[model samples]
Structure formats: C-alpha cells, structure tokens
Target: MDAVAARSGVHRTTVYRRWGDVGGLLADVLDAASDDDWQPPDTGSLEGDLAALNQEIQTAMAAQPPIMAALIAASFRSEKAADAQQRLWEDRYARCEIVVSRAVRRGDIPPRTDARRLLIAATAPLYHQLVLLRTPHDPQLPGHAARTAVLAAAAGAFAEPEPPSADDT
Candidate 1:
C-alpha cells in the first residue's frame, strides 16, 4: 500500500479505503494480471484442449512477466504472496477447469478424474519452468514439451480408460 500510494501519489488511507488493505489491493492486481481475457479453447479432444490451455498460459505469462516476478519475489517472505498465488491460480485455472469439465461431462474424460491436477500438470511445469527458472530453461524447452509431454501427462493422468467390470470374464 505504501509503495502503491507513493507511486500513485495518493494517501495510504485513501488507497486502503478503496481497496481494503494491502492484500486485497494486491489480490485485485494479481487477479487482473493473471486473467486478462483468457478463455480456454474447446477442440473436442483432451489433447487439443490441453494444448490450447497450455498456449493460453504461455501467452498470458509472456505478456505479463512482471506479475510473475512480483509474485515470486513476494513468495519469499509473505503469506500475502501465497494468498495472491492461490487467487491467481483459481482465476486462471477456473477458466480451463470449466473447459475440462465440459470434456468430462461430454464423456471425453473420466467422470471421476481430477481436472485441477490435470490442469496443473499439463499447464504449470512449462509456464513456471520457463518464466520462473533460469536459462537451460531454454524457453524453447517448454514450448516443445508443453505441446506434447506436458499436455500428454495431463490427459493421461486424468483420463481413466474405464474401470474393470465386477463381472469381468
């Protein structure tokens, strides 16, 4: 709040009055940065769906590296960073979850599968490895693997082939 107030030339009290303390203010900003018009693509298959989802994350992270930097820096010392990260994940992942759930409902995915884990596996490694890690991060490393390895892990992990029947013969 102090930093923001200082930057904006507004009183800390004024900022607090509008935003309800620093965490709320940071959450709002983080939510906005994480969710800038990102919508999941439904391509009628888990592979395509995850691929599109990966691209959406890459695009967002690419556009707003500063948001990642801020969150990463804050994560070092404050609970606010964790809260901000959780909110950011919910906002960003919820869109993809809705799309994945559509697949589940349509019988493209197992009804009991864990969509959140699938998304995290498919999506997080590449985005975080690239943006949050140092070189040999290669930038290229994630893009190539993201489309195949990462997305495949997501699809396969969450996709149940079908349960064996109690009456298996």
Candidate 2:
C-alpha cells in the first residue's frame, strides 16, 4: 500500500482508506480489467484467430515486471482477489467464445463445439511454457500451439458429447 501510494502520489492513509487492504486493492484492479472492452482477434479463420490470441497471451505473460503472473499468484492468497480473478477469467473466456462461434458459422469446425475447451487447449501452451516452466520465449510457440488446437478442434476433439438416449438406460 505504501508503495502504491508513493507511486500514485497519494497519501498512504488515503490509499488505505480507499482500498481497505491489499486484497481489496487487488480485487478492484482485477474488476477494472474485467470491465475493459477487450475482444479476441478476428482473423477470419479459426487457426489465424487462435494464433493471434496466443501471440497476445505470450506477450502479456512475457511482459516486464510480469504483472499477470503476480496477480495470478496473489489471487491464491486472497479470497477477494481470487473471486475477482475468476470473474476476469470468465469474462475473457466468454468474450473469446466468439472465435469458436465464428468458426462454426464458417464451417471451419464442427457444430456444438466446446468453445471453452478448445480455447483453453489453444492458450494453455503459452501459459505452461512461460508461466509454469518459465522457459525462454520461442517465437514459433504461438502458431504451433494454435495450429495443433485448430486441428484437434476440427477433428471434433472438443465437440460436446451427446447425452445418453432414453433407450440406453
């Protein structure tokens, strides 16, 4: 709080009064991010769109000071921050669902595709490499992961499984 106040040129007391604590402050920051009008890239094709989105995620994960990583870690320690972070994640996933929807409309992937699963498969590689393994950045990673996911999705790997028919029981 002191550092934030100093950086923002606000008094420490004022910052404390406004946010109450670090968890509150983190939650507010995450909520503000969720309120942004950011949308996934629309590149006409599912592979292109997923590649572009992966690039964005890679850049964010590799940014200096690693604010995204910090927030993710901090969320684990604070209930408020965790809730806010989950909201932010849900908001992003919901927004990105359009990519899958667009692909379905264009006949690029099967109907009733599991958008969330496909998206996570496409984006998880970057997170695993950069955030988990802390591996050096590879320029080919974004496109490679995107291509793999697109292929899997097109093969109906992410299609929603049909429920059992009445006769099965």
Candidate 3:
C-alpha cells in the first residue's frame, strides 16, 4: 500500500479507504492495466483481426510480464481480482465480437458464431506461455493464434448451440 501510495502520490489512508485491501488494490491495477494501444483491428477479414489482437497481446505480455503474472496469480485467490479479471476479459471480448459479427455478415464464417469463445481460444496460447510456462515471449504468436482461430471457426468449432424449440419446453 505504501508503494502504491508513494507511486501515485496519494496518502496510504486514502488508498486503504478507497480500495480496502490489497485485493481491491490489485483489482484496480489490473483494470487500469487493461488500457493499452490495441483496439480490435478491422482488416476486412476475421483472420486479420485475430492476428492483430494476438500481436497486441504478445506485445503487452512482453512489456509487463510481472504485472500480468501478479494479476493472474491474485485472480485465483481474490474475489475482487477475479471479478476485475473477468470484466477485463469481457470488455476485450466485446470488442473482438465486432470482428466476428462482421465475418458472419460477410458469410466468411458461420452464423451464431461464439465470438467470446473464439477470442479466448485464439489467445489461450499466449497467456499460457506468459503466465503458466513462464517461457520467453514469441512475436509470431499472434499470427499463429489468429490462423488457428480462423481454421477452427471454418470447422464450426465455435458454433453456438441451437435454442430449444417451443415444443421441447
């Protein structure tokens, strides 16, 4: 708390009052960290967008591995951290959803495609390398992640389940 207070030039009491504890502080930090130079790209194709997003992820992970690592670790044990992490991801997925919806409209991918799932699958590898394996970052990972998602979508991997018919209910 002192470190955060010193860095932000705020009093420790104010920080504690606002955040209540380290979990809240961590949550706030993680939420703020979500802001970056990347926006989901519109390259006239789903593949391009995913690739762009992946590249951005790789760049961010490389630049702030420790912050990412700390957030991921805290998420497992803190409700505040977990909610913040989930919200951050939800916001990211919402942006990526635009690209998926565009692809659906263009007939490039199937209708009712699960955009959130697709985005998660696409970036899973980079997160694995960053938080779990703790391995060196790879710049090409974004392109590969995008390609894999495109392929999976083409194969109907992220297709949404059909809603129940009226008679079935």
Candidate 4:
C-alpha cells in the first residue's frame, strides 16, 4: 500500500479512504483493465470470426507478462482476487456471446447454442496449459481450440438443456 502510494504520488490515507483495502483496489483495476470496446469482427462466417478471435487471444496470451501467471494462480486461493477474476471472465464470456448470436442469425449455429459454455470450452485448454502446467506455449493450440469448439457446437455439445416435461413430475 505504501509502495503504491509512493509510486502514484498519492497519500496513503487518501488511498485507504478511497479503496478501503487491496481487494477493493484490485477489483477496480481489474474492472478497468477488462473494459474493451473491440467486438469480434464479422468475418462473414462463424468459423472465420472464431478463427479471428482465437488469433487475437493467442497474440494477447503470448504478450502477457510472467506475473500474470502468478496472479492467475493466486486468484484461485484468494477471495478478493477470485471475485475480480470471476467478474473479468464474466465480461469476457458476455462479449463472446455476440459472436455466437451472430452465428445464430447467420444460420451457422443453432439458436440454442450456449455461447458461454462454448467460449469456455474453447479457451479452457489454452489457459490450463499456460497457467497450470506452465508448459511452453503452443502456437497452434488456439486454432485447434477454436476448431474444437466449432465442432462441439455443431455436434450439440453446447446446446441448451431441454426444458423439463411433465412425464415424471
């Protein structure tokens, strides 16, 4: 806290009064950092759009600093960090919904496709390899992930659940 105050040239009391604690500050920073006006580009097809998004994710992941790995790991154990991380991911998944919705409108995917699940399935492997395994980054993983997600969605792997019927109840 003192270091942050010193670096930012703000008084410690002011920082404390404003943020209350490190978690509050982290939440604010994460929220601000998560803001992006860029939407998935319309590449004329769902596959094309997904490929573009995959490339973007790969590029961004490649550029992340080493500290991000530690931060991601810590978020799992820390309540405040976990909350912020969850919010960040929620925002990301919401953004990805646009792509799926567009695909539905284009008749490329079923209207009942679960966009959030598809997006998570698409990116989880990459994140697992990067953060959990700490393995060397695979340049081809993003493309493969996107392709897998497209295939899964086409196969109804991410389809919405069927509504309950009165047969049993």
Q: What would the per-residue lDDT of candidate 3 be over residues 1-169, giving only the tens digit for each residue? A: 6767887899999999999977798878767867765468889988988888888777766663356566667788888988998888888888778889899899988888888888898989888877788777666778888899899998999997995366842
- Decreasing TM-score order of the candidates: 2, 3, 4, 1
lDDT tens digits, residue span 62-82, model 4: 663533444466576667877
Q: Which should have the higher lDDT, number 2 or number 4?
A: 2
Superposition error at 140 for model 4 (Å): 0.8
**lDDT for position 128 in model 2:** 89
After superposition, candidate 3 runs with Cα above 4 Å error: 1-3, 10-14, 29-39, 161-169
Tell me the whole-model lDDT of each prediction, alpha carbons only.
0.65, 0.89, 0.81, 0.75
TM-scores of the models, in the order given: 0.60, 0.88, 0.79, 0.75
lDDT of 2 by residue, 93-166 (tens): 89999999999999999988889999999999888898789889899999999999999999999997885456
Which predicted model would earn the best TM-score?
2
Q: Pick the candidate with the highest lDDT.
A: 2
- In order, what is each prediction's RMSD in angstroms? 5.8, 3.9, 4.0, 4.8
Q: How many angstroms is residue 124 displaced in model 4 relative to the true structure, after the best TM-score fit?
A: 1.1
> Which residue pairs collide, candidate 3?
none
The lowest-lDDT stretch of 10 consecutive residues in candidate 1 is 134-143
Model 1 Cα lDDT, one tens digit per residue, 71-106: 555656656766887777787777677766676677
Error of 3 at 60 (Å): 1.9
Candidate 2 colliding pairs, count: 0
